[model samples]
Every structure is written in structure tokens, then in C-alpha cells.
Target: MKTFLFRSMIGIFFGAFLAVAITNCAVYFGGQELLDGETFLKNSLGSIFCGWFFTVSPLYFELKNLRLSQQTALHFMTVTILYFSLSFWIGWIPLHLKSILFFSGMFLTTYAIIWLSFYFYFKNIAKKLNQDLENI
Candidate 1:
């Protein structure tokens, strides 16, 4: 539970950061005016909620006896469904085919990079543990 909370909080922060950055970029490029404080807060809160949804999958899949590949597949599917659904709901992404395709591609690529990075990180830790075990 502690780990879950910690991870979720981290996700929330990360998501908020990305949301703000993206919004700034949009405003700059699209020549849109800055959002009102209430609107910005609402959007940020929604983003944090979406972030929690995104992070839950990884924690849920971290069970014993599951292969890394299986975990990755499950995570991918869960994030795919949750992200698209949430984005559509929040109007961050349009429900049109072109928008869907573009966002889907971006999401998959980003998640794949994240998953691989975590995979290698844990693999290195496991390797270090095995070395220590061998020395004992």
C-alpha cells in the first residue's frame, strides 16, 4: 500500500508536469490565451487522476511468477485502454481516427521506452543481488 501510494504520487507529479508543459506549448504555438485559474486547476486535477489510473497498472502487474513479458503486455493493454479513454473524455485527444492514430502511436512509443527502461533497471538490480548471493 505504501509503495502504491508512493508510485501514484510520483505519477501524479509527473503527469501534472507534463500537462503544464504541454499546455504552455499549445498556448505558445496555437496563440491561445492562458487559461483561467479555475480551468487550469480543473485540467490539472483531471490529469492527476488520469496519471493515477496510468500508474496503477504497473503496480497491479508486479506479482510473483509472472514473466516480464507478460507484465509488459498487460501494462501496455491497460495503459492503451485507460489513456485513450481518459484523453477522449478530457478532450485532450479527439475521438476522430486521425487523432486517435497519432496519439496511440505517441503513447505506445512513450510507454515502450518507459517499460524498457524499468526492465533494464530491475534487471541490473537482480544481477547485483545474484552476484552478492554468489559471494556469500
Candidate 2:
């Protein structure tokens, strides 16, 4: 129970961090377009929610005995790619994919960034926990 709670909290923190990362990236790259407060807020919140959803697969993999790296990566890619397509197609935020292949490429790139960010965030926490356990 405790391990589950701890890992879940770490996952949630990673989700939040991923959100910030996306928001910061947008601000850096799309400053002019996001000048409006409403657009900025929408993008910020959207990134956070999507980050949370993406983080779930990793957390599940951690909880389960998922050993196949290739399978895990493929599964994550499939889910995230579909999420991007659905979000764009539903008029949720107007992704403007332009092309199916192009959208998939962009989705994979974004997923890689978020996944790496979450990986480091969770690793730091796990290291801290392990050190504390060793001390005790």
C-alpha cells in the first residue's frame, strides 16, 4: 500500500512537471500567439491533463511486471499517438496535424520529451527514498 501510494505520488508529480515543461516550451517558442491570457491558460491546462494521461502508462508499467522494453515503448507510442489524433480531430484544441504521418511524428517527439522528463523526476525521488532506507 505504501509503495503504491509513493509511486503514484511520484507519477503525479512527474505529470505536473511535464505540464510545466510543455507550458514553458510553448512560451519560449510561441510567445506571440500565446500572448492572450485565455489561450495561454488553455494550452497550459491542456498540456497538464495530457501529461497526466500519458504518465499513467508509465506508472502502470512500474506497478506491473512489464519487462519487454520494445513492447512497452510501442504500447506507449500507440496510446499517445491516438490521444494526439483524438484531441485534434475532436476540435478540442485544433492541433492542425495537416498530415497523419506528420502528426504521428510530432506526437512521438512530444512523448519522448515528456517521457524523459518524467523518467528523471521519478528517478531522483526513488534514489532519495533508497538513500533514506539505507540510512535507516
Highest lDDT: give the candidate number: 1
Please provide, for model 1 over 1-136, each residue's C-alpha lDDT reduced to its tens digit, 9 standing for 90 to 100.
Answer: 8988888888898889877887898799978886778767767877887778777778746676888678777777887887777678778888899998998889878887987798799899999999999999
Model 2, stretches more than 4 Å misplaced?
1-34, 63-74, 85-97, 108-136
List TM-scores for all candidates, in order: 0.72, 0.45
Candidate 2 has its poorest 10 consecutive residues by lDDT at 89-98
Pick by TM-score: which candidate is best?
A: 1
- The 10 consecutive residues of candidate 1 with the worst lDDT sum are 55-64
TM-score of model 2 vs. true structure? 0.45
